[model samples]
Target: MAKTTRFATLIILMALACGCAKRSLVALVPDPDGKSGSISVSNEAGSVAISTPYRATTIESAKQQPTAPENIGKKTLDRMFAEALSIQPARPLHFLLYFENNTTLTSDSVQLLPGIMAAIKERNSTDISIIGHTDTVGSKEYNSELSSNRASTVKKLLIEQGAEADAIRTTSHGKENLLIPTGDNVNEPRNRRVEVVVR
Candidate 1:
C-alpha cells in the first residue's frame, strides 16, 4: 500500500510540473484586430496580419506573397513576427522607420532608401500616403511650411528614385501629429519626422 501511495504521488507531481511548464511557455495570440480569431501554441511564436483598409485576397496567401528584401513592408512584417515570438514580448523590438530632423539622411536612412524604393515601386498599384510633421520649435506657419518642405523633399527623392509621381501623395501636419507631445516651441526631435504609408 505504501509503494502504491508513493507511485501515485510521483505521478501527480510529474503532472503538475508538466502543466506548469506548458503554462509558462504557451501563448494565445488574437488576430491583430482582436476579432473572432486566435492562434494557440505550446511555445511562444510570432505571426502576421496585414491591415490595410484596402482588401486583396490574392495577397493573403503566404506563398503568393513576394519574398522578403524584395518587399520592404514584408521585411518589416517578418521582423515584427520574430519580435512577437520572443520569450519576452515587452523587450524593445524592431518597429517602422521614423526619420526625424530636416538635415541630410544618415547611413541608416540610406540603407532604408532601397526599401522605401521597393515600397514606392509597389505603390504604383496601390494608394500611398505620406504624412510629414515637425518639432514644435517655430511659429505654426513656419512649422507648416517647413513640414511641407520636408514631405516634398521625400516625395522628390522617391520620384528621382523612380517612384510614380501620381502614386505618391504628401500631407504636412506641422507638429500636430507628434509621437510625443511637448508644449509649443519645445524641440522634441522625435516629432520632426515623416511617415510613409503604402497600402
Candidate 2:
C-alpha cells in the first residue's frame, strides 16, 4: 500500500509539472500585434512585397470633394489681413489688390484707398510689395509694362497718402498668374488687377 500511494503521488506531481510547462509555453507565443512581449511577430508571410491598401485620405483627394467658394474666401482674406496685422511695417506686409479688366482705377479703387491707408497707418511703417497683373488682351511685353505702370500709379497714390516712397517695392507679372484662366483672346475683368504684397 505504501508503494502504491507513493506511485500515485509521483503521477500527480508529473501531471502538475506538465500543466505548468504547457501554460508557460503558450504564454511565450507573442500576441499578433505585439502589444505585449519582447518579440514581435509580423503578419507578413514571406519575402514577397505585400501591397496594403492605403487607408488615409490625401490632400488631392480631399480637394476633389467639392466645397463652397464662399467658405474658402471668408477664411483666406480675413486670415491674411489678421496675419498682416501681426507683422511689423518695418517688415512690410504683402497684399494682393484686384482690379477690373481694361478699366483704370476710378472712384471704386479710391474707395479701398482709405482702408489701405488705414492698414499702412496702423503699421506705422512703409516697406511694401506691389505687384500688378493683367488679362491676356495685349502683347506680353506691353501687358507687363502696363501692369508695371499700374503698380507705379498705386505706389504714387500711397506715397501721397503718407506712405514713404522708398519703402515700396514693385513688380509686374503681366498676363501671368491670371485670377481666371480663360481662352487666349478672352478678357477677364478680374484679371486686369494689381496685387500688393506688403512683406
Candidate 3:
C-alpha cells in the first residue's frame, strides 16, 4: 500500500483500539457529612449495579451508556460528566504558520511557534508531519525549491526546540495545494504556509 494509505490506516486502527479497549472509571467523592457517596452502572443486558465511594466501574463501550443513579444530586451528576469529559483521549492538533514575502516567517507565524513547541512537549508520544506550501508567484521549479526550503527551516526550528529530529517528516507541495486558489503570480500569504500536524 502507499505511504499515505498506510498512515491513514494506522490512524484508524489506533482510534479503534482506543475505542475498543477495556475502559473503566472510579468515582470517589465524599458526601458533605463524610458519609459514603454512590455510583450506579447499567449495561445493555438491562442489569444494574450500585456501589459506594472508591468502587470502580467498567464502562462497556465508547458511549459509556449509563442509567441514572438511584440517589445522586444534580450537582454531583454534573460533576461526574464534567470529569469524564476532561479525561477523554487527546486528539490530533494542526498548526498552520504562514511565511512572509519569501522564506522568512511572518510575525503571526513567529508567535505560533511557542504553541507548537508546547504541544510537542505536552504529548506523551509524538508523530509530526510538516508540509510546506507556496503561492503561485514563480515558476514551478523555483516554487518547489522555495517550498522545500520553507519546510526545512521549520524542521530546524522544531529540532532546536527539543523535538526529536528523527520523529519529524516533511514534504513540499509547492504551489499545488493553495489554501486560497488564485491566478498565477498572485501573492497570497495564506497559500505560503507550513502545515504541522501533531499526533
Q: After superposition, how far is residue 102 of candidate 3 from its true place, in Å?
A: 1.8
lDDT of 1 by residue, 1-199 (tens): 4543454354346556665332121122334455534322211232334333211111212333321111123232344357665654232111123455563444466577678777545434345666778888888898898888877877787778877788878888887878897998887767777777765
RMSD values, in order shown? 16.6, 21.8, 15.6
Model 2, C-alpha of 17: deviation from truth (Å): 47
The reply for model 3, stretches above 4 Å from the true place, is: 1-88
User: Model 3 over residues 1-199: C-alpha lDDT tens digits?
Assistant: 2543444344346556777666544344556467874555666645345555433333556565643223333344345478775776677789999999688999879899889989988884468999999999999999999999999999999898888988899999989999998999999989999999888
* Per-residue error (Å), model 3, residue 198: 0.8
Superior candidate under lDDT, 2 versus 3: 3
Quickly count the clashes in candidate 2: 11
- The estimated TM-scores of all candidates read 0.50, 0.51, 0.56
Model 2 regions lying over 4 Å from their true place: 1-103
- Residue 179 miss distance in model 1 (angstroms): 1.0
Best by lDDT: 3
Q: Write the per-residue lDDT of candidate 2 for residues 69-160, one digit (tens) a residue.
A: 11112232234347754653354455555565543674566688777777777876556778888888878888888898889888888889
Ranking by TM-score: 3, 2, 1
Q: Give me the displacement of residue 152 in model 2, in angstroms.
A: 0.6
Q: Which stretches of candidate 1 lie over 4 Å from their true place?
A: 1-103, 122-124
